[model samples]
Target: MKPLYNFILSAIGATLLSGCASSPDHATAGHDAAAIMPASGGPLLPLPGESLVPAHDPDDGLFMDALSSWLEQNNAPPNTQYEFTRIDLDNDGRREGLVLMQSPHQAWCMEYGCSLFLFRAHDDGFSYLSEISPVRGPLVVAESQTSGWRDLIIHVSGRQNNDARNVALKFNGRGYPSQPASAPGLAMNMLDVTGVKIFP
Candidate 1:
Protein backbone atom coordinates (compact mmCIF):
# COMPACT_ATOMS: atom_id res chain seq x y z
CA MET A 1 0.00 0.00 0.00
CA LYS A 2 2.81 2.37 0.79
CA PRO A 3 4.49 1.62 -2.49
CA LEU A 4 1.34 2.27 -4.41
CA TYR A 5 0.82 5.53 -2.60
CA ASN A 6 4.38 6.55 -3.37
CA PHE A 7 3.93 5.71 -7.03
CA ILE A 8 0.78 7.78 -7.20
CA LEU A 9 2.57 10.72 -5.63
CA SER A 10 5.50 10.40 -8.00
CA ALA A 11 3.26 10.20 -11.03
CA ILE A 12 1.25 13.20 -9.94
CA GLY A 13 4.41 15.18 -9.38
CA ALA A 14 5.82 14.29 -12.79
CA THR A 15 2.51 15.13 -14.43
CA LEU A 16 2.24 18.48 -12.72
CA LEU A 17 5.77 19.35 -13.74
CA SER A 18 4.88 18.48 -17.33
CA GLY A 19 2.70 21.57 -17.56
CA CYS A 20 5.40 23.93 -16.47
CA ALA A 21 7.60 25.75 -19.00
CA SER A 22 10.57 25.46 -16.64
CA SER A 23 10.73 21.71 -17.11
CA PRO A 24 13.87 20.26 -18.66
CA ASP A 25 14.22 21.16 -22.32
CA HIS A 26 15.53 17.94 -23.80
CA ALA A 27 14.84 18.84 -27.39
CA THR A 28 17.75 18.50 -29.80
CA ALA A 29 17.94 21.91 -31.35
CA GLY A 30 18.60 22.21 -35.12
CA HIS A 31 17.29 18.67 -35.70
CA ASP A 32 15.18 18.32 -38.83
CA ALA A 33 11.79 16.65 -38.69
CA ALA A 34 12.52 14.84 -41.94
CA ALA A 35 15.25 12.82 -40.23
CA ILE A 36 12.84 10.81 -38.16
CA MET A 37 10.74 8.11 -39.72
CA PRO A 38 6.98 8.54 -39.68
CA ALA A 39 5.12 6.55 -37.01
CA SER A 40 3.92 3.04 -37.95
CA GLY A 41 4.36 3.88 -41.65
CA GLY A 42 0.59 3.58 -41.85
CA PRO A 43 -2.13 5.96 -42.87
CA LEU A 44 -2.59 8.76 -40.35
CA LEU A 45 -6.14 8.78 -39.15
CA PRO A 46 -7.84 12.10 -38.76
CA LEU A 47 -10.12 12.94 -35.87
CA PRO A 48 -13.80 13.25 -36.79
CA GLY A 49 -14.33 16.45 -34.84
CA GLU A 50 -12.78 18.91 -32.45
CA SER A 51 -11.96 16.34 -29.79
CA LEU A 52 -10.57 18.27 -26.81
CA VAL A 53 -9.52 17.01 -23.40
CA PRO A 54 -12.45 16.59 -21.04
CA ALA A 55 -12.42 18.86 -18.01
CA HIS A 56 -11.74 17.27 -14.61
CA ASP A 57 -15.12 17.97 -13.20
CA PRO A 58 -16.82 14.99 -11.62
CA ASP A 59 -20.04 16.72 -10.56
CA ASP A 60 -20.81 18.33 -13.89
CA GLY A 61 -23.41 16.36 -15.80
CA LEU A 62 -22.12 17.63 -19.12
CA PHE A 63 -18.61 16.56 -18.22
CA MET A 64 -19.83 13.08 -17.35
CA ASP A 65 -21.81 12.94 -20.57
CA ALA A 66 -18.84 13.89 -22.68
CA LEU A 67 -16.60 11.48 -20.82
CA SER A 68 -19.03 8.64 -21.27
CA SER A 69 -19.49 9.46 -24.91
CA TRP A 70 -15.74 9.49 -25.48
CA LEU A 71 -15.29 6.22 -23.64
CA GLU A 72 -18.05 4.55 -25.61
CA GLN A 73 -16.73 5.91 -28.85
CA ASN A 74 -13.28 4.52 -27.97
CA ASN A 75 -14.77 1.09 -27.12
CA ALA A 76 -13.85 1.24 -23.45
CA PRO A 77 -16.00 -0.94 -21.21
CA PRO A 78 -18.80 0.93 -19.50
CA ASN A 79 -17.78 -0.30 -16.06
CA THR A 80 -14.10 0.51 -16.33
CA GLN A 81 -12.52 2.46 -13.48
CA TYR A 82 -9.77 4.93 -14.31
CA GLU A 83 -7.89 8.04 -13.23
CA PHE A 84 -6.27 10.48 -15.63
CA THR A 85 -3.83 13.37 -15.81
CA ARG A 86 -2.75 15.77 -18.53
CA ILE A 87 0.91 15.89 -19.55
CA ASP A 88 2.78 17.36 -22.47
CA LEU A 89 4.27 14.11 -23.71
CA ASP A 90 5.77 15.48 -26.88
CA ASN A 91 7.00 18.82 -25.59
CA ASP A 92 5.04 20.43 -28.39
CA GLY A 93 3.35 22.91 -26.04
CA ARG A 94 0.28 20.65 -26.01
CA ARG A 95 -0.74 18.27 -23.26
CA GLU A 96 -1.66 14.67 -23.92
CA GLY A 97 -4.18 12.89 -21.72
CA LEU A 98 -2.91 9.92 -19.72
CA VAL A 99 -5.31 7.44 -18.13
CA LEU A 100 -4.49 4.63 -15.74
CA MET A 101 -7.26 2.06 -15.61
CA GLN A 102 -7.86 -1.11 -13.65
CA SER A 103 -7.37 -4.10 -15.87
CA PRO A 104 -10.30 -6.49 -16.26
CA HIS A 105 -8.10 -9.55 -16.02
CA GLN A 106 -7.51 -10.16 -12.36
CA ALA A 107 -5.46 -13.24 -13.16
CA TRP A 108 -2.66 -10.96 -14.29
CA CYS A 109 -2.30 -9.71 -10.74
CA MET A 110 0.24 -6.97 -10.28
CA GLU A 111 0.95 -5.03 -7.15
CA TYR A 112 1.80 -1.74 -8.81
CA GLY A 113 0.83 -2.16 -12.43
CA CYS A 114 -2.20 -0.97 -14.38
CA SER A 115 -3.47 -0.42 -17.88
CA LEU A 116 -2.27 2.84 -19.46
CA PHE A 117 -3.87 4.82 -22.24
CA LEU A 118 -2.51 7.85 -24.09
CA PHE A 119 -4.90 10.33 -25.64
CA ARG A 120 -4.03 13.12 -28.03
CA ALA A 121 -5.71 16.40 -27.22
CA HIS A 122 -7.74 18.32 -29.75
CA ASP A 123 -10.10 21.25 -29.76
CA ASP A 124 -13.30 19.24 -29.32
CA GLY A 125 -12.04 16.41 -27.10
CA PHE A 126 -9.28 13.87 -26.54
CA SER A 127 -8.69 11.02 -28.98
CA TYR A 128 -7.30 7.63 -28.07
CA LEU A 129 -3.73 7.33 -29.32
CA SER A 130 -2.22 4.20 -27.83
CA GLU A 131 -2.40 1.78 -24.91
CA ILE A 132 0.06 -0.19 -22.79
CA SER A 133 -1.11 -2.96 -20.50
CA PRO A 134 0.47 -3.75 -17.15
CA VAL A 135 2.47 -0.59 -16.93
CA ARG A 136 4.58 -1.04 -13.80
CA GLY A 137 6.02 2.45 -13.64
CA PRO A 138 4.99 6.04 -14.22
CA LEU A 139 4.68 7.20 -17.84
CA VAL A 140 7.55 9.54 -18.68
CA VAL A 141 7.75 11.71 -21.76
CA ALA A 142 11.34 11.98 -23.00
CA GLU A 143 13.29 12.98 -26.05
CA SER A 144 14.16 10.18 -28.45
CA GLN A 145 15.99 9.67 -31.72
CA THR A 146 13.02 11.29 -33.37
CA SER A 147 13.38 15.01 -33.69
CA GLY A 148 9.79 16.11 -33.99
CA TRP A 149 8.31 14.71 -30.76
CA ARG A 150 9.19 13.20 -27.39
CA ASP A 151 8.95 9.47 -26.71
CA LEU A 152 6.90 7.64 -24.08
CA ILE A 153 8.90 5.65 -21.54
CA ILE A 154 7.56 2.86 -19.31
CA HIS A 155 9.42 0.56 -16.93
CA VAL A 156 8.10 -2.95 -16.41
CA SER A 157 9.26 -5.75 -14.10
CA GLY A 158 7.10 -8.59 -12.86
CA ARG A 159 8.73 -12.00 -13.14
CA GLN A 160 11.36 -13.15 -10.69
CA ASN A 161 15.10 -12.96 -11.41
CA ASN A 162 14.65 -10.02 -13.76
CA ASP A 163 15.43 -6.38 -13.13
CA ALA A 164 13.01 -3.76 -14.37
CA ARG A 165 13.43 -2.88 -18.04
CA ASN A 166 12.76 0.51 -19.54
CA VAL A 167 10.73 0.53 -22.73
CA ALA A 168 10.70 3.64 -24.85
CA LEU A 169 7.79 4.09 -27.22
CA LYS A 170 8.98 6.57 -29.81
CA PHE A 171 6.47 8.68 -31.66
CA ASN A 172 6.38 8.82 -35.40
CA GLY A 173 4.82 12.07 -36.60
CA ARG A 174 1.47 10.30 -36.90
CA GLY A 175 1.44 8.06 -33.78
CA TYR A 176 3.53 5.71 -31.63
CA PRO A 177 4.80 2.34 -32.74
CA SER A 178 1.98 -0.21 -32.65
CA GLN A 179 4.41 -2.91 -31.47
CA PRO A 180 7.39 -1.53 -29.58
CA ALA A 181 10.76 -3.26 -29.71
CA SER A 182 12.21 -4.98 -26.66
CA ALA A 183 14.86 -2.27 -26.38
CA PRO A 184 13.58 0.85 -28.04
CA GLY A 185 16.01 3.57 -29.01
CA LEU A 186 19.58 3.36 -27.65
CA ALA A 187 18.71 0.39 -25.49
CA MET A 188 21.95 -1.12 -26.73
CA ASN A 189 23.73 1.37 -24.54
CA MET A 190 22.15 -0.28 -21.52
CA LEU A 191 24.18 -3.11 -20.05
CA ASP A 192 22.41 -6.41 -19.33
CA VAL A 193 22.33 -7.03 -15.57
CA THR A 194 19.60 -9.62 -15.39
CA GLY A 195 19.78 -11.66 -12.15
CA VAL A 196 22.78 -9.61 -11.10
CA LYS A 197 22.46 -7.30 -8.11
CA ILE A 198 24.80 -4.33 -7.89
CA PHE A 199 23.63 -3.10 -4.48
CA PRO A 200 23.78 -6.16 -2.32
Candidate 2:
Protein backbone atom coordinates (compact mmCIF):
# COMPACT_ATOMS: atom_id res chain seq x y z
CA MET A 1 0.00 0.00 0.00
CA LYS A 2 2.86 2.36 0.70
CA PRO A 3 4.24 1.83 -2.78
CA LEU A 4 0.83 2.46 -4.31
CA TYR A 5 0.38 5.62 -2.26
CA ASN A 6 3.77 6.94 -3.32
CA PHE A 7 2.91 6.22 -6.94
CA ILE A 8 -0.22 8.30 -6.68
CA LEU A 9 1.76 11.15 -5.20
CA SER A 10 4.26 10.96 -8.00
CA ALA A 11 1.52 10.94 -10.62
CA ILE A 12 -0.16 13.97 -9.12
CA GLY A 13 3.16 15.80 -8.87
CA ALA A 14 3.79 15.10 -12.53
CA THR A 15 0.70 17.08 -13.42
CA LEU A 16 2.69 20.17 -12.45
CA LEU A 17 4.89 19.93 -15.51
CA SER A 18 3.10 22.92 -16.98
CA GLY A 19 2.83 24.76 -13.68
CA CYS A 20 4.63 27.92 -12.65
CA ALA A 21 8.20 27.98 -13.83
CA SER A 22 9.50 28.85 -10.37
CA SER A 23 8.25 28.16 -6.89
CA PRO A 24 7.35 31.23 -4.87
CA ASP A 25 9.27 32.23 -1.76
CA HIS A 26 7.73 30.60 1.28
CA ALA A 27 6.13 33.16 3.55
CA THR A 28 7.37 33.65 7.08
CA ALA A 29 4.43 35.77 8.16
CA GLY A 30 1.81 34.81 10.71
CA HIS A 31 -0.78 32.16 9.88
CA ASP A 32 -3.50 34.79 9.44
CA ALA A 33 -1.28 36.93 7.21
CA ALA A 34 -2.69 37.68 3.82
CA ALA A 35 -1.02 36.02 0.82
CA ILE A 36 1.26 38.14 -1.32
CA MET A 37 -0.72 39.92 -4.00
CA PRO A 38 -0.26 38.97 -7.64
CA ALA A 39 2.15 40.78 -9.89
CA SER A 40 0.89 43.77 -11.85
CA GLY A 41 -0.98 42.83 -15.01
CA GLY A 42 -3.89 43.70 -17.24
CA PRO A 43 -7.47 43.56 -16.05
CA LEU A 44 -8.48 40.10 -14.84
CA LEU A 45 -10.71 38.00 -17.04
CA PRO A 46 -14.01 36.62 -15.83
CA LEU A 47 -13.80 33.05 -14.45
CA PRO A 48 -17.08 31.34 -15.16
CA GLY A 49 -18.11 28.37 -13.00
CA GLU A 50 -14.75 28.42 -11.26
CA SER A 51 -16.07 27.39 -7.90
CA LEU A 52 -17.41 23.89 -7.09
CA VAL A 53 -19.55 22.88 -4.14
CA PRO A 54 -20.76 19.49 -2.95
CA ALA A 55 -24.43 18.98 -3.83
CA HIS A 56 -25.28 15.63 -2.22
CA ASP A 57 -24.36 13.11 0.45
CA PRO A 58 -21.92 10.28 -0.27
CA ASP A 59 -22.93 6.64 -0.04
CA ASP A 60 -21.74 4.57 2.90
CA GLY A 61 -18.42 2.78 2.29
CA LEU A 62 -18.63 3.46 -1.42
CA PHE A 63 -16.06 5.83 -2.94
CA MET A 64 -16.79 5.44 -6.65
CA ASP A 65 -20.56 5.56 -6.25
CA ALA A 66 -20.45 8.71 -4.13
CA LEU A 67 -18.08 10.38 -6.54
CA SER A 68 -20.26 9.53 -9.56
CA SER A 69 -23.34 10.86 -7.82
CA TRP A 70 -21.51 14.03 -6.86
CA LEU A 71 -20.34 14.66 -10.40
CA GLU A 72 -23.83 14.25 -11.82
CA GLN A 73 -25.42 16.54 -9.25
CA ASN A 74 -22.82 19.20 -9.97
CA ASN A 75 -23.17 18.74 -13.74
CA ALA A 76 -19.49 18.05 -14.17
CA PRO A 77 -18.00 17.14 -17.52
CA PRO A 78 -19.53 13.90 -18.81
CA ASN A 79 -16.18 12.23 -19.42
CA THR A 80 -14.65 13.11 -16.07
CA GLN A 81 -13.24 10.26 -14.00
CA TYR A 82 -11.61 10.71 -10.58
CA GLU A 83 -8.94 9.03 -8.42
CA PHE A 84 -9.66 8.66 -4.74
CA THR A 85 -8.45 7.26 -1.42
CA ARG A 86 -9.90 6.62 2.00
CA ILE A 87 -7.89 7.09 5.18
CA ASP A 88 -8.53 7.94 8.78
CA LEU A 89 -7.46 11.52 8.40
CA ASP A 90 -8.25 12.45 11.98
CA ASN A 91 -7.35 9.10 13.52
CA ASP A 92 -10.87 8.98 14.93
CA GLY A 93 -11.24 5.21 14.64
CA ARG A 94 -13.02 5.72 11.31
CA ARG A 95 -11.88 6.55 7.81
CA GLU A 96 -12.50 9.69 5.75
CA GLY A 97 -12.46 9.91 1.97
CA LEU A 98 -10.63 12.23 -0.40
CA VAL A 99 -11.35 12.60 -4.09
CA LEU A 100 -9.32 14.30 -6.80
CA MET A 101 -10.99 15.13 -10.12
CA GLN A 102 -9.50 17.06 -12.99
CA SER A 103 -11.43 19.73 -14.85
CA PRO A 104 -12.01 19.66 -18.61
CA HIS A 105 -11.13 23.33 -19.08
CA GLN A 106 -7.49 23.49 -20.03
CA ALA A 107 -7.34 27.26 -19.84
CA TRP A 108 -8.36 27.14 -16.21
CA CYS A 109 -5.77 24.48 -15.53
CA MET A 110 -2.76 26.73 -15.76
CA GLU A 111 -1.27 25.00 -12.73
CA TYR A 112 -2.49 21.54 -13.66
CA GLY A 113 -4.94 21.86 -10.84
CA CYS A 114 -7.84 19.64 -9.89
CA SER A 115 -10.97 19.80 -7.75
CA LEU A 116 -10.50 18.39 -4.23
CA PHE A 117 -13.26 17.10 -1.98
CA LEU A 118 -13.02 16.09 1.69
CA PHE A 119 -15.52 13.75 3.25
CA ARG A 120 -16.19 13.34 6.96
CA ALA A 121 -16.68 9.92 8.44
CA HIS A 122 -20.24 9.37 9.53
CA ASP A 123 -22.05 6.37 11.01
CA ASP A 124 -21.09 3.85 8.30
CA GLY A 125 -21.66 6.72 5.81
CA PHE A 126 -19.67 9.71 4.70
CA SER A 127 -20.84 13.30 4.55
CA TYR A 128 -19.61 16.07 2.30
CA LEU A 129 -17.34 18.40 4.21
CA SER A 130 -16.08 21.00 1.75
CA GLU A 131 -14.70 21.42 -1.73
CA ILE A 132 -11.71 23.32 -3.11
CA SER A 133 -11.18 23.71 -6.79
CA PRO A 134 -7.92 24.20 -8.64
CA VAL A 135 -5.78 22.74 -5.89
CA ARG A 136 -2.27 22.12 -7.25
CA GLY A 137 -0.42 19.96 -4.73
CA PRO A 138 -0.80 16.61 -3.02
CA LEU A 139 -3.53 16.55 -0.36
CA VAL A 140 -1.66 15.69 2.83
CA VAL A 141 -2.89 15.01 6.34
CA ALA A 142 -0.90 17.02 8.82
CA GLU A 143 0.61 15.62 12.02
CA SER A 144 -1.23 18.30 13.93
CA GLN A 145 -4.85 18.54 14.97
CA THR A 146 -7.40 21.24 15.63
CA SER A 147 -10.37 20.60 17.89
CA GLY A 148 -9.43 16.92 17.84
CA TRP A 149 -9.55 16.62 14.01
CA ARG A 150 -6.33 16.51 12.00
CA ASP A 151 -5.62 19.38 9.68
CA LEU A 152 -5.72 19.00 5.88
CA ILE A 153 -3.15 20.98 3.93
CA ILE A 154 -3.12 21.66 0.17
CA HIS A 155 -0.72 23.51 -2.07
CA VAL A 156 -1.92 26.16 -4.52
CA SER A 157 0.55 26.92 -7.28
CA GLY A 158 0.64 30.16 -9.16
CA ARG A 159 -1.59 30.48 -12.22
CA GLN A 160 -0.12 32.49 -15.05
CA ASN A 161 2.95 33.50 -13.04
CA ASN A 162 1.16 33.98 -9.74
CA ASP A 163 3.00 32.87 -6.57
CA ALA A 164 2.63 29.35 -5.23
CA ARG A 165 1.63 28.68 -1.61
CA ASN A 166 0.07 26.16 0.74
CA VAL A 167 -2.97 26.51 2.95
CA ALA A 168 -4.22 24.52 5.93
CA LEU A 169 -7.88 23.82 6.62
CA LYS A 170 -8.97 23.00 10.15
CA PHE A 171 -12.16 21.18 10.88
CA ASN A 172 -14.98 23.38 12.16
CA GLY A 173 -17.36 20.78 13.62
CA ARG A 174 -19.01 20.46 10.21
CA GLY A 175 -16.36 20.78 7.51
CA TYR A 176 -13.02 22.38 6.83
CA PRO A 177 -13.71 25.91 5.66
CA SER A 178 -12.22 27.31 2.46
CA GLN A 179 -9.92 29.79 4.17
CA PRO A 180 -9.09 29.17 7.77
CA ALA A 181 -7.93 32.25 9.70
CA SER A 182 -5.02 30.52 11.41
CA ALA A 183 -3.63 27.00 11.69
CA PRO A 184 -0.35 26.44 13.57
CA GLY A 185 0.99 23.34 11.90
CA LEU A 186 3.39 22.13 9.25
CA ALA A 187 2.53 19.99 6.24
CA MET A 188 3.72 16.41 6.29
CA ASN A 189 5.67 15.04 3.34
CA MET A 190 3.58 11.84 3.33
CA LEU A 191 0.13 10.61 4.26
CA ASP A 192 -0.53 9.21 7.73
CA VAL A 193 -0.93 5.42 7.46
CA THR A 194 -0.09 4.20 10.94
CA GLY A 195 -3.09 2.60 12.60
CA VAL A 196 -1.71 2.89 16.12
CA LYS A 197 -3.28 6.29 16.73
CA ILE A 198 -6.86 5.16 16.27
CA PHE A 199 -9.25 6.66 18.79
CA PRO A 200 -10.78 4.20 21.21
Best candidate, TM-score: 2
lDDT of 2 at 25: 18
Question: Across residues 127-146, which tens digit of lDDT does each residue of candidate 2 receive?
Answer: 56666566554555665677
TM-scores vs. true structure, each candidate: 0.50, 0.52
Please write out the lDDT profile of model 1 over residues 123-154, one tens digit for every residue: 33445566555664444555344656566666
Query: Once superposed on the true structure, which residue ranges of model 2 sit more than 4 Å away at CA?
Result: 1-61, 106-112, 159-162, 179-200
**Pairing residues by index, what is the TM-score of model 1?**
0.50
Q: In candidate 1, residue 183 scores what lDDT?
A: 44
**What are the RMSDs of all candidates, in order?**
16.2, 18.0
Estimate every model's Cα lDDT from 0 to 1.
0.41, 0.42
Off by over 4 Å in 1: 1-67, 103-112, 143-147, 159-163, 178-181, 184-200
Q: Estimate candidate 1's alpha-carbon lDDT, on a 0 to 1 scale.
A: 0.41
